[model samples]
Target chain A: MDVTLLSTGIANVASVSAALARLGVRAAPSVDPETCRTADAVVLPGVGSFAAGMAALNRHGLGTALKARIEEGRPTLAICLGLQLLSESSDESAGTPGLGVLPVQTVRLDGAPRLPHFGWNRIESAATEGLVQGGSAYFAHTYCLRPSGRLEEAGWRVATSVEGAPFVAAVERGAVVAAQFHPELSSTYGRDLITRWLERARAQSAVDTTQGATPCR
Target chain B: MSMTRIIPCLDVRDGRVVKGIKFQGLRDAGDPVERAAAYESQGADELCLLDVSATPEGRGSALETVAKVRAVLGIPLTVGGGVRTLQDAERLLCAGADKVAVNTAALARPGLLTEIRDQLGAQCTIVAIDAARTAADPSRFEVVVRGGRDRTGKDAIEWAKEAVEAGAGEILATSWDRDGTGEGYDLALLEALSQAAPVPIIASGGAKTPEHMAAALRAGASAVLAASIFHDAETTVAAVKSDLVRLGFDMRLVSAPMLPSVSENSPLPS
Candidate 1:
């Protein structure tokens, strides 16, 4: 599969790319808008400030391409800050706008003893089968989109976790999956999650090829 | 809130696993990559690789070691030792370390922590403080550096606050008085540091048992990091995690069915 991982210029990208390599996939990291827009599978992995991440994407013109890909229902997996970038806006940087693909506000996580909820935490999802299956995952973030039933009302499968407050862990709609947790860092559960997402991405790409090319499955 | 993190700290000297003075001569025990994979399999939430052999001039082997371990380690890995400059921290992060710890160097010149934050956010800057009980004041803990060989007059609590002001995200608090004494963690020290530092405090040294770890957590530690208990074959990360669970501490259980074992030749996650 032609997987283009949108690199937001963070340093710890090795683990994410290595995990992809283990699954018999070489996810080439790229900031080129065309490559990001046209890839069979696009992974948006990010860390650091939301403003910086969105700035980098906008600077490279990949943000618009990314929103276009998601608008077209392409297979794209967004992780951590990447997930936040798909929201409408964020409290971390109020002036900086998100892709608004998910129609949610990325607010500061409240009710937590610590600001940045680091370490491993349990994620509970009711979906029988999807990108997340209610497993323990690694999380490191100070801001998150609070669960207000708005995402579910919009017909998206949402996973929720508590770190002093209930928040949206992941949301999947069609082939567009975004995770607030770092599935790439969750060890076996993490590996299994990526494998499952890739399988879905691969199947989606094959279907696209079939539809685009006359019943050639 | 979040679950208590169980971290197994690997002491590396010149890129080899150094299990303190008493070497645990297991088969290929000196290899950092092997031990890291084993710990992840055993359910460690995170791994801290401290290069004990790193001098003022950082060794390139440390970076190589971090890169190799990160290739197999799925969880977060924090690297320390010989990180005297902001460049060293950047190089280590590029080599795949999720967080960089500064001890002696940060103590000498406090600006390095701020520089790391300015370049690469405070989320990656960790200040490791080695504190010992002073005869001058048992209630107070003094900062020790150079692997606890040199004692600086700075107070541990005061330094932690200062480091946090200079952009430190977390404090790796090690009790020099109880490092290897097997008594337990200095709950008083944990309490003091937790009071002083607003950020997450990772308790290190003197973790004799799971009960000791629980005590440290109850005393306000966000995570518990141990070395001899894990490296000496007395206990495994899995055992400690289970014990913590049984003792009523909320912890994320680990079971890696897809991760390949160190001895396995398989490249794919089954």
Candidate 2:
């Protein structure tokens, strides 16, 4: 499968691209929207602040391209800062406009233990979805994605949550999948998700080429 | 009412599976996916995979490992090491991990907990606090991160409450002063942490015996996790569960087919 790793000039883009390659995916770092559209899947891995990441995407004109690709039913994976950019906006750096792919907003974890939550965590699943095999994965972030509706129905929504409010950690709409955590950095289970995504992208590629239909719509 | 949990943690390095002594010399632990499955078979309540590496390049291997681990274990798996933003947590979850654990980052941005909790949901996020008692404050432990490389100087008890209020649904408090020592459970820290927060607490560090497990439970730990005991075959999952049951903790016994551990380089099972 042809997979384009969106190079927003974020940290560790090569890592993710390399992982996808192991899954038989033709991974390439693409800043051009046209190049992104040509691939079966797009992976956006970010490492900087939300505002800066968005600015980068905007500068490369990939923001509109990303939305268009998602609307077209192409699968996309957004990791770390990439995932935050999927939301409406965040207070982290201020004035950062998210892609608004999911109906959610970002905010600081008030009273949080510290600046960045760096360690392994457990994910308590509230429902059955492909994203959740069962337990938790690692996490690191001061801000999270808050979504209002059922994650599945919203097309764009948070995958998991803390307490009662759901954070848009991972979003899946048919073929479109994105997350707030760095799966490539997660360990074995995290790598599995990337492998599965490549498979999904391949499957979706077949459908996209044959039916010429937008699965997301 | 409280909830039941199972966790599986993997040793990581350069983004792959690695193990080592207490925050020091490290070694490989084979493929992460294989190790995770072994833990699941043993009925791990939850899983924590920590990247022992400090370099950014090595951190990349950690993300690759999570993507692999998430594919095999159908249970909750948390990923850590060098995470600094909400996007990190989201990416891990997207790759199939259920939650993200923050340490150094959370200490740097205390309000970040609330921000992440507010965005995700407090239940899905967790704060992994590594604490060590200081000579100046022998009675109090302080939160440390970077694999116990950096000290936050924040009081452990105070930080636990701050984490919960910030949206952390759970806390994995590891005692650095006692980690890998296996002398005994850090009951004083557990007791204090439990009192400070309403969320579930997983008592880590210095778990030496089944008796230590009981002591932790009595001290208000929601769960007890140990590496030496678990990895050395010193105790089996059934034995530990039995011990918990005998200690008055309710446990469900289930018998499922145990599958052979699959290699990381192998194709996924059907």
Candidate 3:
């Protein structure tokens, strides 16, 4: 499957691309809105501040195109800062607006032993289908998304946690899914997660083709 | 809880892996790609490639080696030595390095740390401090540069604190006196730096056994880095990890299937 990886200009795109290639999926790094809109799947991989990331997306004119794809129920995966960028705003860069795809806010992980929650931590998955529940993934960030609100009516659910403080580890609302961990650097479990996402993209493409929709470019 | 990382440092000069006794008497270890792949298969948590030459002519070859090693390895790769400017760090990152370690240049111009951090994020910026115990004052350690050939009078602990405040996310503290001696890590130095630096401290130099690693971790190091042990094949990454686990240190274990080999059922795409 061909996937368009949105480059926020601060992430390690090479590593993300290599991870996807290992899962048998072709990944092309692009900030072009048209390319992102035409792919079988779109991955928003990032590793920088919310302000810098959002500025890059706006500079490339990809802000609206990305939101439209997710709103249309297209397969999209946001990792780390990419996940934080989906929120309404973040404490990391005060007053900076996020993509606002998910109704959430990102804040510094207070009361933790350190600032950047660096290293591997076990993720207790809330759902079974979208991500591998009960597995550890590598994390390296100081801020995390506050837990989803009101379980029943909330559009998203908590996919994982580190410590008792629950954050949006993986969120699934329609075709929009995201993880607060670096799957590209999470070793075996990371590879498995990418494989699962690619399989879903392939399955979705098959369905679209059967319904006479244009295939992803 | 954060897992303790085991990093194998490959000192590369002229594009070849080299090991020396206290930064002298350099000898070839092996090809960078081959040794890096071998260590990865052995379950090394991370790999550090330090260009010993750190010269204009050698910088090109070091980046080429980094790209080649990155192509075959899946773990995080940190390239150090000769990273003086933001452009140098950018070039290494573009070549597939997850992080870049800066030492001499950062010390010369402290602002370089902040500059690199602003451009690349603190997570990608690591300050490598080479330190030696002061003869007059055994309690305090002095910073050394030029591969431990010169001493700068600045206290090691003070320098670490300054580097962290300057936006360095981690400190690679190498004990120059204990380096390559196989006498084990300088626990007193690790303890002082760990207490002084807010960011994670990677205890480097003079690691001989798993017990030594344990001692460093107990003394408050976030990770343990060694060169001679892994390069000389006196021990394996898996063996050291298992030993650490037995001693109750949190370590990431590589499952049997993850062991190095070309399998017919490999999950990698064709």
Candidate 4:
């Protein structure tokens, strides 16, 4: 299946591309809107600041394409900062607007022992199927998506957690999916999560074809 | 965090894995890619590649080695040595290194740390401090650079704090006095650094047995890094991880399913 790995110019895009290749899936790292909008699946992987990531997407004119994919219920996965960009706004890079796919705001993990919550943490998956439940995933970020009051209304679910503080680990609202941790770096559990997401994307594409809908290129 | 990490540090000189006693008497260990794959299969949580001879010529060879290793390895890879400028760090990152470690350069110009952090993000920046106990003042330690060849007269603990404030996400503190001595890690140094720095501290130097690793973890290190023991096959990553787990220290055990053999060629469940 064709997978478009969106380049925000802030993350380790090579690692994600390598991981996809190892999974026997074809992926292209691109900033072009057409490559992202027409792919069977799209992944927005990021590592740097929210402002820098958003600026790149805007510069490449990928913001509108990403919105179109989400609105059409196409399969997409965002990792780490990519996950943060899906929110409506972030306290980090103050005044930077996110993609607004998920109705939530990302904030710093204040009062924690450390600033950037580096290292692996167990993710208690809320979804029963197609998600690695109760497995640890690598996380390296200071800002996180806190439990939003509009979570239920927006059809958002907390896919995992570290302590009692719930962050949006993985959200499955229609075809949009995101993980706050680096699945590319999370060893086996990470590989499995990516594989499951790809399988779902492939299945979704097949269903679209059967419905006689012309897939966007 | 899930568990304490067991990182196998590969000292590469001229693109080959090498081992030495406290940065002296260098000996070839093995090929970088072969040894890296072996470590991954043996359950190493992560791998670190230090180009002991990071000359302009050696830098090209190191990047080639990094690409080869990255091709087969599924875990995180951190590359260090002679990373002087932002471009150097960018080159290594582009070559497939998950993180770039800066030492002498960071010590020479502290602002380089901020520049790398701002450009590459602090998560990708690691500050490796080679520190030796002070001769005149036994209670303190001094930061050494140039592969532990020169002493900077700077306090190790104080430098660690400064590096963190300057945007280093992690500190690889190598105890020069204990490195390759096989006595054990400098627990007192690790304890002090851990308390002083807010970021994760990776304790390096002087690892002989799994118990030594356990002691280092208990001493407040977020992770334990070893070279000689793992390179020489004196111990395996699994043994050390088992020891740490047995001691009740949280560790990510390399399960059978986590092995690299479970690649794309492997069958997937429907």
lDDT of 2 at B218: 82
True contacts kept of 3: 0.23
Higher-ranked by DockQ: 3 or 4: 4
What DockQ do you compute for every candidate structure? 0.52, 0.04, 0.47, 0.52
Candidate 4 residue-wise lDDT, B106-128, digit = tens: 98888998988888788898999
Looking at candidate 3, what is the lDDT of residue B133? 95
Q: In lDDT terms, how accurate is model 1?
A: 0.83
On residues B169-206, what C-alpha lDDT tens digit does candidate 1 reach at each position? 89999998887667899999999988887789999988
Error of 2 at A10 (Å): 6.2
Residue A109 local lDDT, model 1: 84
* lDDT of each residue in B55-132, candidate 3, tens digit only: 698999999988887776677788899998999988888787888899999888889999988777777888999999
lDDT of 2 at B76: 53
DockQ of 4: 0.52
* Interface root-mean-square deviation (Å) of every model: 1.5, 10.1, 2.0, 2.0
State the lDDT at B84 in candidate 2. 85
DockQ of 1: 0.52
Candidate that beats the other on TM-score, 1 or 4, i.e. the better one: 4
Q: Alpha-carbon interface RMSD of model 3?
A: 2.0
Top candidate by lDDT: 1
All candidates: TM-score: 0.92, 0.57, 0.93, 0.93
